[model samples]
Target chain A: MEPLTLDEKIRILTESARYDVSCSSSGSSRSNRKGGIGNAAASGICHSWSADGRCVSLLKILLTNHCIYDCAYCLNRRSNDIRRVALTPDEVAELTINFYRRNYIEGLFLSTGVVRTPDYTMELLIETVRKLREEHRFNGYIHLKLVPGADPLLVERAGRLVDRVSINLELPTRESLALLAPDKSREAILLPMRQVSGLITARRDEGRRAPPFVPAGQSTQVIIGASPESDLRIMTISEQLYQRMGLKRVYYSAYVPVTGDTRLPALNSLPLLLREHRLYQADWLLRFYGFTAYELLEADAPNLDPELDPKTGWALRHRQLFPVEVNRAEYEVLLRVPGIGVRSAKRIVRSRRVQRLRLEELARLGVVMKRARYFLTADGMTSGEADLSSERLKALLLPEKKKRSGPEQLSLFPTNDSDLSALTGEL
Target chain B: MAIWRYDGSFTGFLTLCAALLSQGEEPEEIISAEPLQNDLFRTIISVASDENRGEKMLAAIASRISPDSCRLLWQAFLSEAPGVELLLWRYLSFGRTTGVKCDRFLAHPAVGPVHRLANSVGQEAHRLMGIIRFQETAGGQWYALVEPAYQVLELIAPHFAARCSDMNWLIHDRRRSLAVAWNKQEWRLTRFDAQGVPPLSADEKAWSTIWRGYFAAIAIPERANLRLQQQHLPHRFRKYLTELEKPPRR
Candidate 1:
């Protein structure tokens, strides 16, 4: 085959790499050095959003599509005869610089399928990042992926170079991993995660002398729907990743079937976008809203409610927590209200410090009265239909389904992703 | 009742505030003295822009109320929304008594409009920081065009300045006829004219083609949600986005 041009390499690599959904460029405050070309914004910037509604924060592409392990659910599996290509370290660095120059991307997100061995793939990724940072003097945000079984030494070196690093814990359970991705072991995945976590903490303790170790911290992805693990299991894993591993984020990607394998789920099972969306909501509740996996779901009730959000679902289940008095409730209690978010909760606490919050005032402060009015009281007054039964309230709170008509009208103010907008605090 | 008119500058509005507060006269209306906005019934007092008086009023707000309140007022002023001057005046007046915690009084009628205006301007500025796209010129200068709802060039210039400190760039606000020019060191806001597409670099076409291709290739076809895409990148913004532009025929 003729050598692929840079354009061809970019298209193929980006197509293969889009499924690994961890595209955040936030959390790092790396500033531009003398003669450096860029800096990292503490709140990540999205240059453009793709058609799937995902923010294109970084230039996400693979270093190589060549692989040894054939993960059954993966697009780049060795068994699949897809077009294969690889870019040199210099080529990747030049692409990043040119894209950054045109304001097309914030930085580079470099991931790869194992080229020869885990060690070789790790070396390829680290070299591309090092060339971008050291040779090109690029101070932009870079998120590098750690090959699952790569040597710990290379992982440490990668941790020190990039702004953020990650390794995808592809499945939630050991049985699922064994059945689907037999080449990847549970220990091999967690090793780099634990090592990077320890290094980040130890470096923080070592202070200014040790330099920064993944200043944006580490994150990982867990594929949903491919395996039989329930939403509860996914939330439990994410919670552990946050608390135990000290991971900044745990992304949940809904399984998009690419290859046919006997072990894989049926082809008719469409991508579980709604389930993935609920997991994202539950993940936010765990990280910011002071909720636990146990509180969100029980072993029997493993799946998140398809019709309602995780917060509203929890609020309905725990009826005793309703009618939270906004004027007198604690900040944590206020956060549990169905419609209130982190920002509105803080605003309620702040505004109440000056004066008692009334029902009208809560709306002005950005409280979603549609859902919150059923869950809270303001200034000793309950809103309309506040005393209704849980079933009735759930019926009222369920989002009114839009009729799919001749042509979908684009709303000037989109409410479809209000829950998501609140999570990212973007748009 | 009397209506106050200013020369349509932030300092001019501040001077109007200084004049009204000194005289203890209630303002029935505060409008900009541009495009001939006038009233036949009320007495019109045209206030001129005074640098010293404006600075003094700014210092007073910072010291008496809060520096954040000053920032809020400036951002609201940049919005160019109708009746924002009166809203700022009312907010400042309320802040005098409420003190530094005036901003936290979100429920107060006087404070809410100013807060919303400032918040809108700030949000638009942040959004434009990401939406603005640059293409390299033949002379190695990077150029972009923006037509934001608010005059956000001054608000967003510093961000690009810090990120692209080593490169020369120009971000032109075609709607406001203003631009920010950075020459590898400092940036300055200057008047700019709308012209046709400038001569681009030789490699610009290929890079942009790849960008558009990458954009198209990155979206998951199974999860194509045009509603969500329109939510983030609205139709208004697609006009200048290079990725959304149609490629030339072979």
Candidate 2:
């Protein structure tokens, strides 16, 4: 009701931010000292790219946590029992300035509720960021939350100011949106995300002479497990986001329910952290690992194998593709093997010039031997062990991995991996 | 075998590498005799402070040997090993007649001993880069305390000047008893054996608060690989910071 105090605002904003997956990187948690002002060493690592391209960390916090809508999966949703607070533009700016001056953080992460109206709340956020940048001359990195349903004018203005803007697509599907989060619509979220994406594209095409709009680009969050979509659908949703939406990152936050709503699935209250971790891995595969969502999923096979990573699982299912000769394999073929990353592929390419590249050379270049050995023939040698069958290899490779950790957890294709893939009503 | 002593500098070592690698009666006897005993058990020859001869020697090695091969000798010389001058002499002598290329030494049986010596120098160079903690001085000059493993003060000065371009910084490696100073535009090295550094007034409390909050906030418990985190940012380095003091996550 009343504008909350600074502490109350921090509590509300930070609690509300808990459901938002992007900020897990401020740092790990730590115990507070009796007289200390803040804690930087606890249990996390928030790294940032310094002006010199060094990834450093800065305190990441929200200005307020109170929300207007009743998002089923959000901790800051209207009905959650959380303390509420809101720091003034000056207070937020000062805290950031104080922390930055002391090298406490790389920058600030400011998010807010749709307080009263979307534009009104967005303005409060912009004012805080504007004052911080213009008046205070705070030049470190800043990640601003571009509130969904906010005015396009406000979203564009905010996009031009912040390093990164994230408009969360809280639920994966429109049907799920109606069933679980009744207030939020598909267009309401996509419109703002599209606006920000377009703004970034326009600025880039114009060759922005000055600082770029959203230099780090736009990222969105999807609350996994809150809806009824499978992993295949989830990854498809992710694929379209990257290919069509032109999003930089689509963060998957496993649904952790805060309120008991019969309509909402009961299992989602705890952070589906493992699933979230898996989705991030899968997302990386699509973006950097050169993996396609179609390759990651089959028509009827719905989920990623929880036992092995998507890449490893892919290799296992397609055993006929094994023993790729490292000395002669193309970069594309090298990428198909389970354990070789981009760096290793480059290293493999580099080493081939200097030497004929025996099995020992790949190990020297940092290829994980346990997984890679089955898939690669170093020099001219494949496995001397003929008994190294696909099933036997999986048994040996993942002896401790008798249980799989994620299939749905890894939303391989953000826009297409889940329900959106099914209804690609467009595709 | 013979030893050729140096004035403890990389260029001086490069000079030594050049002279030994030259083809004549074979200077396979190069080694150091700087009050330290020679491991190679070679004849010791302390070349006089003749800049011209040193330059001539370096130029010769750079010419006869591959520029890359000469560079490896230069690395060995900077290591300040008692017999690097001798080993480079041996390697060069071997290269002259037998064609022992530089790449061979990188994975050579004899290169292990040479690398162990060269690594001592490189480790210091890397340590000075990371562990040389800087402090804001009263006179606007930033003072850093560095306890490097080797005599790497001369090696790291130019880097500081370029990285902290606007500031005048002084890095004093107390153990090596030398210091590097940057005067905004250029860097200069000097001998500095200050008895003890003034106690650093790092805002331990403020840094701790910030570090704790930072460490806690960044780690995704779902993704907190303690083993991986420890590997990247070790536990030993955590004691001085704000965050590592916290207990492990259960």
**Candidate closest to the true structure, highest DockQ:** 1
For A334-388, candidate 1 gives per-residue lDDT tens digits of 9999888887898888889898989999988889888898888898899768678
lDDT of 2 at A386: 38
Ten-residue region with minimum lDDT total, candidate 2 chain A:
A418-427
Residue-level lDDT tens digits of model 2 in A1-427: 6765444455445445544555422221222233222222222233322111112344456677667888766666788787666678998888776554333454677887778888899999999989976776554556788777888999888877666788877778889887877778889889988887777777768864755687767788887887888787889999999998798778776665566877777764224655555667778789888898888878788777656678887888888877789889998889888768776787677657545777765665657777788888887796576346777877876636325463222222222121211111010
| Model 2 CA deviation exceeding 4 Å by range | A1-19, A23-56, A208-211, A257-272, A386-388, A399-427, B1-9, B23-40, B44-232, B245-250
Tell me the whole-model lDDT of each prediction, alpha carbons only. Answer: 0.86, 0.62
Q: Looking at candidate 2, what TM-score does chain B attain?
A: 0.68
- The reply for model 1, stretches above 4 Å from the true place, is A208-210, A267-271, A405-427, B35-38
Looking at candidate 2, what is the lDDT of residue B112? 39
lDDT per residue for candidate 1 within B1-250, as digits (tens), equals 6888898888988888989889987798898854374446668888889999999989988999988888989999999997888888889888878998898899888987788788789778877777788989999999998899998899999999999998899999998889999998799999999686679999999999988889999998877768778787888899889899878899
Best by TM-score: 1
Worst 10 residues of 2 chain B by lDDT: B100-109
Candidate 2: tens digits of C-alpha lDDT, residues B1-250: 5445666555565555555445343554443335455456566655544577667765655666566665566556666665565566566655555342444433233443564466557544643343344555446556766555566776667544544555567877676778788876678888888875454445534433544454454443333344334433444444433344564455
Compute the lDDT for candidate 1.
0.86
